[model samples]
Target: MTEPTDKVDEQPLDEYLKGGSSVSRQYRQLPGADVPPSLDRLVLRQAEEAVKRPSRPAWMRWTAPLAVAASAVLVVSIVLETGLRDETTVSAMQEKREAAEAPIETRMIEEPASEPSANAPAADSAAAELVMPVPPPPKIEVPPPASASEMPMTAVQRRAPPPPVAAPAPAPLEEQVAKAEERDNAAFVADVARQKSALEAAARERELSASQRAMRGEQAGVAGPRDTVETPEPKAVLSYSRPISASAVVTSADSMAKLEKTYTDPEAWLKDIRQLRKDNKPEEADRQWKLFVAAFPNYEVAENDTAREANK
Candidate 1:
């Protein structure tokens, strides 16, 4: 049995190597072993039909997704539009409500004013009385008075003369005149003193100017001209006073010039005003602020930059 099995396997291998065997030929020739002619024709026809048929457009692949996306976008837009419309409607309704309530509120406020109060009756009665016309006074007719000649004389004609009028008591004219004379004397004395002081100041100023001129001339190596006529020193009519120095006058003038400085640039002016405030010069700051307003009327200023005191 082992020998027969080996022989069978060897026989098939030998026939396969030899190209083919009768059984292989018989299998190949079987009714449905190879594809039928009709099946080949049908397959070829199907292949031809597939090739001839037009392919779907490339864009068709995205149609469903694009449609879905468009639907989603349209839905979102509609929702947003609806929301906006709702918001607008709500706002309009709110405005309408406010407008409708405004008149009611006004009426409520006006009703109290229109209605009569506790004192209305008394005020109305007083007004009515004032408005009413006044009645005319009754006329009284009397017979004409008898003439003076016909009138009876009760007493004799002798009447004592009226007492002589006394003159008004004299005012304290002498005392008043003396007081006025004293006041005038004092005023004259003060005036004289003031004039003396002024003259002294002028003399000092002239002396300073002369000295400055002399110094300048000396520096330049030239002789300064001297006045041929000398002004006499003014006599101290009332009292002598110390004269102001040239340096003091110069310093005061410098300060006055600084205070009177004008600012053309608004920013610089504002900066200086702030600096004044920082330096604790509120009065100067306020004054400068007023000047700034006058200089630039259209310039806007901050509230805190105004004067520290409300009254200012």
Candidate 2:
């Protein structure tokens, strides 16, 4: 019975070692178990929180050490500088103290030595030998004064005086206006003189024509029933005719005449011309235009039908 029981136990053990049990087969056939969704979410959330947890800044990692090192360096430097300052100060103070004590030590030694003694003569001779006589001051030679020819010229003497500044230039606008006014006055005087001469000439011509007419009439009376002679028309006289020069003779009468009112101002003259045109006196306007052009050659006329027609 014991042997059979042993055999039974060995058979079961062999089956278990061979993995041929029903339990093992059933375990292999079962579906694989998965982690719970809640557990998985909890783990993942924990991982994220770990990842997101704020850590010390990278700069902070080195800042403390760097600050420590810098502070150490500063301290070392300060210590070294302080030590050097102290050494220099101590050295200067020691030198000053030594200098201050030197005069007192010298006085002490001289005072003891200066006391009367049995070997006074010997001491006196020793002191006399030790003490040196003061040296005489060096002589300064007086040089003779140099002659003017021998003396070197200074910078001020060599430099020449600056030239005088030139007078300021005249203002262009004022000068132009003055010159234009002078020209206008000259032209006006000349025109007046010319007009006066022309009037005088016209009067003379008319008188001569009348005298000839009378003489012919007398002749006709003497020679009766001859063909009637036609009297020639007198030439048309121009107003404001003038030579352009200072030599023109302007009489006081001409200046005082109503003709001077025509061209006193260029604008006024233009207005008169415009007025003449408005009044249907084209011939008179045209003649005034010609005079205006001659007087003020550079003046710009206003664009109008009258000016255009006159220009044509």
Candidate 3:
């Protein structure tokens, strides 16, 4: 029973190793961690020594140990036998001989030439330190000649490095939208202000042009008829259309009647005229102001008096 059990345990390991049926896998299932093949052979020798009997048959006593020793040699030779696979021709044999005798480190690094396999066995790490793979020669870039004529016909220039990727902004979508909207509103307000300024500028420019023309006319002994002269209409200032305040009353009545009601309150009348100016109805305000002056020439109101001159 013990013999059968021993055979069963050792059979697969020996078969895989000797038959070259994935020897690495067989080694992987060994009892110890990172147990080398040499160490394994030593351990097996010790195990055989322990299992031997002085009274056993001479044939069995020697044969078992001899078999175990043979297996160990076979394993060692198998790994070293890169030459045996190609024994067909003299050239192949010669190449194999050259490869077989080569240094272990050289054999490990370079491929056996005659074989089609470009694959080299992973060398033992202990032996790898002795002969490191030769470092690739340094690449020294020779600068172009100072004279343009001496420059190469086609020079290989390294491509520029790629631009760094920008990270996405941390702000939320709603915040971004709000910011964009705020910018748009600010731009709109600025444009409106510019347009208003342009209109006001155009009005001043027209006035200056008219004054220049009048000066020219006076120099030529010509007087423009005052009654026929139409005043330049004031341009409307751009502003938001505000909803009427609760306190602001909307009344539909004759301008004269409205003026008469506010006769006792000159400040109220002046405020109404200012409102008219703001509404771009300076001409109507001027007409009502004239009526007020006609109604009360002796009445002295500073605001009204200033407005009277401005209207004229």
Candidate 4:
């Protein structure tokens, strides 16, 4: 029984030494994992009867683990050395500061800001070294790390303002003056044209009056030569009227009372004058027109009609 158990244990080694039994078959069946070419060649050489190669040394089996441990030890040593160096530097600086301040107790300097006496002793000069207090460590207030929802928002994009527009320059002084003078000249010409039109209208009115008077058996000629001619008094005329939106025209009692000797309506008096003219009665038409003027002193027709009749 002992012999069989010994054989069972050694069987796997023997099988490996020989072609490596069932495990090799199962390894070959892994879907995409290919056996390395070098490993396959080594296995082929081992399987052949004539091929002879030295087995790997025992120490070679521990090579990978030893390399890994060496790397880990190196990294750990570097980290520890860095920490020790930092601590040593801080302690050295503290000791140096204490050594510098310890000498201040031996001296009796009252004013720290004032200069020392010019004849001070060498020992006092050496003892009166300037001492500055160590600055406090900066308070690095590290805020808690924000969660996904509390993260700061992106910077807002600002729109640039519109660019300033250039304004047009004003006209030159000389050009402005020329334009004003041209405008004045044009206005003067328009005034002259208006006066000429008024004179032509007056001439036409005089001709019509002469013809009408001639038909009514009245003389149609100028009164006398220029030196002896007397210009008649100018008749008054008014044309102001109420706007269309106003209520009916309202006459005062005094105005109605003043119109005693003439027809109430200027229209009726004008019609009566026209009828007398048709009957070839110039004197009667003239008389009625005079009464019409007295009745409605503000009639615009009074000036034109009176001018026509007076010239005739």
lDDT for every model? 0.41, 0.42, 0.37, 0.37
Sliding window of 10 residues with minimal summed lDDT for model 2: 134-143
Per-residue C-alpha lDDT of model 2 across residues 95-120, encoded as one tens digit per residue: 33333233223322333211222334
| lDDT, candidate 1, 46-160, per-residue tens | 9999999998999999999999999999999889777766665555434333332332233324333112223344434443333322111110001111332322221111111
Candidate 3 residue 28 Cα shift, in angstroms, is 95
> Over 4 Å off in model 3, which ranges?
1-171, 209-312
Judge candidate 4 at residue 79 and give its lDDT: 86
lDDT of 3: 0.37
- Candidate 4 at residue 6, lDDT? 52
Cα misplacement distance, residue 10 of candidate 4 (Å): 44
Q: What is the lDDT of candidate 1?
A: 0.41
Measured by TM-score, how close is model 4 to the native structure? 0.22
